[model samples]
Target chain A: MTRRSISLLGVLAASWWIAAPTGWTHRLDECLQAMRVNVATDRLTLDLDLTPGASVAGQVLALLDLDADGEISATESVDYARRLLRDVAVTLDGRGLSLHVVSADASPLAHLKSGDGRLRIRAHAGWDALGTGTHVLDLTNRHLPSISVYLVNATKPADPALLLGRQVRNPHQSEYRLEFTITRQDATDPSPP
Target chain B: MAVWLWASLLGVVPVLRAAESAAVRVTQAADAFVRTLNESQRRGVQFEFNDAAQRTRWSNLPVSMAKRAGLRLGDLTAEQRAAAMNLLRAALSERGYEKILGIVQSDEVLRRQGNSTVPFGQDEFFISFMGKPSVSAPWMLQFGGHHLALNLTMAGDQGVLTPSLIAVQPAMFEWNGKTVRPMGRETDKALALVQSLDATQRKAAVLAFEMRDLALGPGHDGETIAPEGVQVATFSAAQRQLLLELVAEWSGIIHDAAAQRKLKEIESKLDQTWFAWSGPLEAGKAYFRVQGPTLIIEYAPQRLGGDVTMHIHSMVRDPTNDYGKQFLP
Candidate 1:
């Protein structure tokens, strides 16, 4: 979907839903959140949950405040973060795989700003990586850990036999180098680490 | 223990082994525990020394979400559990062992309260080892579940406990007919130190940006963090002593002899240690940061929907050496 539609959703959330107290001050409380990546046979489901990064509020405000009006409409702020998902890297076997903006909701963003004080934002992105042979899955994390605390789990639930192991980043990078090995039907998979 | 004492010990490896130091005791204890694992359990517990992914696959996340490798406490038999606890005794000081047990017991309270849908209990904790346990070889003892992740690395007679997580939810909970607070020392001593600072000192000590979680934590291995907050050099001698005491509350979580050596390293770098805190200093909600040339400790409360200040997330790391780096070769 277009960024315009995503922004409209945020605006509707702000006007339709109630707002709570928010600011950098929320950092005062303890915040522990996680981002999970569940691998399916044909596609990869990426989830960003737990809580929005500590810096997300300010970052959204800065990006969406285009009019220099010193005020960012709820839609603009939420859409600004959604647009960032475009840069979310999902690759198969070392090659970049195309990602579809599956669904983006601003309720977590809205509640995070005011509602229940959970400061949560749940977003999902998916891409096709189905095949018969072996494949490797990897992604570059943008919002979660760099902004706050995030734990990534890359697992294939359908085939218990397939093993998924992750290789993390350089000091300056936020990439998860996941190597997935495929074998013949008669062959055995490598031992899990 | 002093640097000179360490130097003299280094000169004589045989005496270091025969003196019954914490390293030797822990090695013996670990050896005994490994022997009790029978056959299949041993395969699950021991990972190849070069198994990079397994070594780094630990987390403070819930078990259902973040899985761990190694033999879990729940899987052990009665005799095996006793051996596991004995190994912990050899690795941690009395206070440290109590801290680990207290954190584990809090999970048991959660199970009773029915706040969680997934599995949780004291027995859910796990133990794992990387490389063979020898007094002279470098090895690591990793034990954690839910709110605990302890990575103790030993190199010869020297020891380091860093890149570890010591966090608990429900900051204060009623358990075993008594009120329990796992991170009580970290919370109380940090507040006292913050209160001790005057206006000028407080200005330097309070961080502008509120830290919601530890800046350096799991998966942030080898990352660099610049020091923030009040440096120990500016404090009075008494205040500096207080800072050292506070540090000991975390570093000394290891065995006594090893912990003493860890303290000596920090004491030598008093001028470099920094203590910074965010949020109001009042009891319920606050975050504190303590970083130095060799150490980094953080304490932050978890905002789990309820306005009640109960859940907490804290971490302790050694910037230069974590996961027994000196022994890797």
Candidate 2:
């Protein structure tokens, strides 16, 4: 293709990119993939994930397990989900943005039921537009080892793009998981930090 | 364009002027009512009237038990209490006075249900006067009982009190085997309005997952969020009328002119509001909730004991100007 034609094509592609959903799903998936955890005991685990470039502040990881078992139950696997979202300092393109937790939900506390393992939890997150760009979800835990799981946006076809999986073992084991979502730029952008 | 804007502004000036005048008239009426109180009655009017301090003390936003329990009208002699009642009658409209009486009588309703033996005691009520009774100064008259809190704030002669939370528990009860309804009529009327909505309107109005309580609980100040999900404009004419009636029942708590002024404001925003509910709409069961832009009302039924649900809790909160924040610096 001619240089001018190539430039024109690039511009068109960029325009479409700007109009897209910011590929936040892609970032979330990436963070989930990189999540690491150390399971020491069957009851609790630890998680680790990156604090993305542009992100909400004070996002903490909450453990969601099914079966109400004292240990990670068979009904559902345990994983790190975001909690306590807040505005935090983010370095982006060399600029700063204020983060805010728009909405959030947590898992119910796990309890030991007769001798069977079970999991129970509720996960939720909503964000207030903060100059939409890219943000990260981080997880950190320090209690029950061998019980950690990291969740990432699922991309496998026929399977949900979001999945909870056990994180790899690490010595520094502060069980936590961090995730990210990239929000493409939009007009009527919120004010900067 | 600027000239056109200016012309429109000029056109609205007369209406604004009229509203201002009406506000003034309402304040004058309220003040006149207060002036009618005798000496002993005036003493009862003071905040914490039963306390030795005599002077009213400023309280934290979501008035604590210490503040509410400290003020008692029952401490006064029978004659003083009577005079105080007269003062209240003068300060509020006839309908407003009736509302107060209805709430007070609910205590007896509770007693009849064996909820409490003490009946309605003075410690159960808290009254505070926001400003001097002058027509010009910003002021408010606030009174709250177990399941009720009413605040009327006036500024530039205008009085506005909305999202008035009025709740009755044991919402349905048998008094001597006859159903006694202290606040059922109003609650049922609101429910009727919601049930009458069309599918599309209903979807718009129902915004949350399970209605539970008013979003604006005590101590949650200036946390009012904009009404989302549905706007009142979607309702049919008949449905809209029902909405207005509900709003009117609240605004009517003020005397006439102020009530009219508030009604006008509420009507203007009808298209940009929402109504939500939680729990079963049946009688004799515990359930409650109401949420809208600029207003939120909650009602819940509670079982005081003895296989009888004989208690209610209700509250109203204004998103923009609750507790007279608009009038404050």
Candidate 3:
């Protein structure tokens, strides 16, 4: 995968998947939305693992099994993923970044009903290669705020050219602010001034 | 490569006899290993007991895929390397030590395959310690590489082997002109337990979908799910015994004293323990978890590569005390 392409999501997922920790404890009647952010020289990726507890699984399933088929088909899984992303906002250096789905995996409906299934989605947004300097990225997830608990953190950047700084999060963790710096080592790489 | 050969040739001399407490033997062995290291290597292998970053720095992937922090076995001299293995031998049972060697050997096989983009071999393994060796205090012994991570915590007479990963890329390979399957017992026992279930039991024990990966694998520290599958409280006498035997494959990897303590603790929670299965009953095609209040073990077969049977990933964790957090306070 090249730096300019969205396919970087797949490559990043394989490498960062093992490091994605679910440090949040799931509640009995709420949804736990755990997000792991990965920053690269040219893109930022997020892996979301949405798990609904037993009491609220029906509510989540109602939104996922739109057709009431009792099963989540491949198309339904992707559609639900897209719908979920609608409530997510990402901004890089005050500029809005567009997000695209790289992959979505829905656990079996039975597993969800048991309150242990994890609906995993990997999304990414690419940008021009960062120049040597500090940048701020803000992300917010307003999905199911009434019954949702959030956990979010940025992984140590996989690319040596990008250095991650302090992370700021709202009490609920629905709002995440990250600071990162582009190293001078990448200064020679051609990019927009 | 020389380190592996050296350890194997010497058979990792045991540092202390069974008369000593498991923690005492482990602490002595750790001290011996550190004494063998040069100043630079000693600095590389020692960390503060509270260094959470280094404590949890472990994975089942190749070094290129997931970097490890410790004294790389390959960098040590033959005597230093043998001392390292001896520390592990002191901490783990005789069989446990062999299993670790088998996992290392399996990685050597993967390296010979020359198919993987990432590096693999006995030389890729590492060993480190969190806190100075002391039989009366808390400390951790961390060792691992591709397909294996053994994080053992010693506190007084207690030893906790939770939060360890035991996996194999080539589940079966040749060693010393003999066939070796590092996790063969884990696979066979799980399958046997699942197959022994009656139709009604199967309905309770089996999941409706395939599990492609571990639910509580590396990096998943504080998170734990509600217990599912069939609880052992409902098991018949014979079936219950089978379950305990299966659970031993994970808990028994520690020294005899600690392994006995863990097994007894698990047995006391029989009513709370649950065994869940996914995929077919055939070996290499199944995924199973033995979860309880204190322990969670997941065995998952990788779909990558041509045969899923050849690649496996499994994790063991103690929900109440991973990385021996409970031992601290």
Best lDDT goes to which candidate?
Answer: 3
Tens-place lDDT per residue, model 3, A1-193, is 5665657786677666334221111134678787878777778788889988767899889989999988998888888888999999999999999888888898889878756576888898889877888999999999999988776756545455676775666666788888888887454322111
* Model 1 DockQ vs. reference: 0.03
Write model 2 residue lDDT over A1-193, tens digit each, in one string. 8999999999988885455332111111111112212111111121123221112111222233333343432233323323211211222233333333322222222211111112222222223443433333343333232232222211111112222232222323232232222233332322111
Which segments of candidate 3 are over 4 A away from where they belong?
A1-84, A87-193, B1-20
List model 1's recovered fraction of native interface contacts, to 2 decimals: 0.00
The stretch of ten residues in a row with the least summed lDDT in candidate 1 chain A is: A21-30
Per-residue error for A58 in candidate 2, Å, reads 30
Runs of candidate 1 with Cα error greater than 4 angstroms are: A1-82, A85-193, B1-20
Report the Cα interface RMSD of each model, rounded to 1 decimal: 13.1, 23.8, 16.9
Candidate 3: residue A74 lDDT (0-100): 81
Q: DockQ scores for all the models shown?
A: 0.03, 0.02, 0.03
* Cα lDDT, all candidates: 0.67, 0.44, 0.80
Indicate the residue-level lDDT of A27 in model 3. 33
lDDT of 3 at B42: 90
